[model samples]
Structures are given as structure tokens and as C-alpha cells.
Target: MSDTFDPDHLRAELLPLSTLQAPSEEAQAYQRFYGLNALGPNGATSSRIGRVEVGGYDIVTQLWVPDQPVGTLVLMHGFYDHVGLYRHVIDWALGLGLAVIACDLPGHG
Candidate 1:
């Protein structure tokens, strides 16, 4: 890959993540900048980050699950926030054996 934004390739890789998989190299770069992997809070049974088109708008989404999750939690961020900013929250929910799904606000992060 080059130093460019390759949406097609990313979609090809990300679209298959039903429950989530390892991050691609390009994704790792962005993840670092976004603190997606901060503090080693990666105890999820599976996790995924992807984009979805809803009402013709692109939104970044993340899902994290723990083993034997008792329930699910849909997290939301404030204005100008992204999913990466809530890693701790994700970790907390996962620690409580809850699956978490969150998305970035439009045109932010």
C-alpha cells in the first residue's frame, strides 16, 4: 500500500469482519493516532472497526465483545468525537461482560 487513503482496499478487508479480525497495517497507523489500542485494554473475545452507510452518510463503527457477554451496550459519543476516544469505556463494558457497539459522529474523528 502507498501513502494514500485506499477506501476500496479497506472496504475489501473490513467488510468481511463479522466479529472482527486483526487490523491491517494501514489501519494500525490510524489506530495509533486515534489511540485505538491504548493501555493494552484488549481482552475482547472479538472486536471490529468499520464504516457503514446509513441514510447516505458514512459512519465509523466499532464493536467489542467479551466472552459470555450478559448483554449489549450501544455507546454514543459527543460532538466532534470518535470511537477511538472511548477505549476505556469499551474496556470497562467488556470487563463487565457486556458487548459494546459504538460509532463516530458524522464528519468527526
Candidate 2:
């Protein structure tokens, strides 16, 4: 893992981040930094990462579903934020039996 919290280090560790997969250490560091898979829920009945066209722009998207979701949460991060930064919220919704669908803002992520 990188010694510092480099945003580049956090990039491209998996699908929807980069076309090429990176080392697990890098990916784990990102998860740890965000307190995911540790400080929050991590399990999901189903998870998907891909891209979609939104308003004539291609955007990276991710979806998480619980065993039997009662509703869905369309999460949006703050300014300059990407979908990965909100796993806690996503997991929270999943734990509450709700599906989550988040995407990188146009030209952001």
C-alpha cells in the first residue's frame, strides 16, 4: 500500500475504476481508509460495476442489492467525490434491505 493517501493510489484497483486490476494491497488500503469492510457493512447479496450512458455521457456505475431489498437508494456523493467514497452509505442501505445504485458524476469519479 502507499505510505500516503494518494488519490492515484486509490484509483484503478478494480472494475469501474480501471480496465486493469491492481494489487490487493492497494485495494485494501482504499477500503481501510474509508473504514469499509471493517468500520461498516461490506457484504452484499449482489454487486455489479459497469458503465451507462447518462444525458449523452458515459458514466461509471455500481449497484448493490441485499437478499430482499424493500426499496432502492440512489446515492450521490459530494462535490469532487466518486461512487467509491460512499460504500458506507451503500452498505447501510443494503443492511436495511434496500438496493443501492451510485455513479460517478460526469467528468468526475
Candidate 3:
């Protein structure tokens, strides 16, 4: 991890925006700071990103699978939290050979 990791930058990227349009600049900053793409490489595993429609809204989802999985671990972010904030936990889980599945809650993050 780089010493320049900024929590503010990550928080800005994770903020819920009123507009539906994507902010390319913030997204780029997030990629650079976190060393992870929206749905690309993550440490030793490549993650899969998708969305599931429940009720009348779309919920973002992410899955990280190791080469040889021993079990599955579900990660749920707390209030005002996002998946990016749980990278360390995810890394730890991956190291333990546990596949991780995380999702953005209904209206949080």
C-alpha cells in the first residue's frame, strides 16, 4: 500500500451523488489511489462486478474468488460505508482461502 492513501479521496468516490451521471475524474482518482479497477484485478484475484435488481432498484455487487476456495464469506458494509473501505478485510479473507461476496446496501454508499 502507498503512503499517500487518502481516506478523503476514497470517501468522495463512495459518496452517493444526486445525479445519475458518472464522475470520471473521481473514478480515476479512486482507481489510482486504491490500485484496483472498478471490476478488474485485485491482489491475486480478479473480481467480478455486477448489479441485481431487487424490488425497484439496482443493487451493486462484487465477488472475489480465489484459485482454490475453501469457503465463502459475505461482507456487508455498515451505515454510510462502501465496499472500497473493506479492502483490507477482503484481502485478509482472500488470504484465508475464503471467497468474498460484498454488496452495497439499498440506499447506503
Question: lDDT tens string, model 2, 43-97?
Answer: 5455554556668866666566777779999988878887667766776777788
Q: Extract clashing residue pairs from model 2.
A: none
Q: How many collisions per candidate?
A: 0, 0, 0
TM-score for each candidate, following the candidate numbering: 0.71, 0.62, 0.62
**What shift in Å separates residue 103 of candidate 2 from its native position after superposition?**
0.5
Identify the runs in model 1 with alpha carbons over 4 angstroms from their true place: 1-22, 38-44
In Å, residue 72's CA in model 2 sits off its true spot by: 0.2
Ten consecutive residues with minimal summed lDDT in candidate 1? Answer: 35-44
Q: Clash pairs of candidate 3? A: none
In model 2, the runs with Cα more than 4 Å from the true position are 1-44
As for lDDT, the candidate ahead, 1 or 3, is: 1
Residue-level lDDT for 107 in candidate 1: 67
Task: Tell me the lDDT of candidate 2.
Answer: 0.61
lDDT of 3 by residue, 28-102 (tens): 454445544433134566555455556876666667788777899999989999887887788788888888888
Candidate 3 ranges beyond 4 A from true positions: 1-42
RMSD of each: 4.0, 4.7, 7.3
Arranged by TM-score with the best first, the candidates are 1, 3, 2
Q: Evaluate model 1: give its TM-score.
A: 0.71
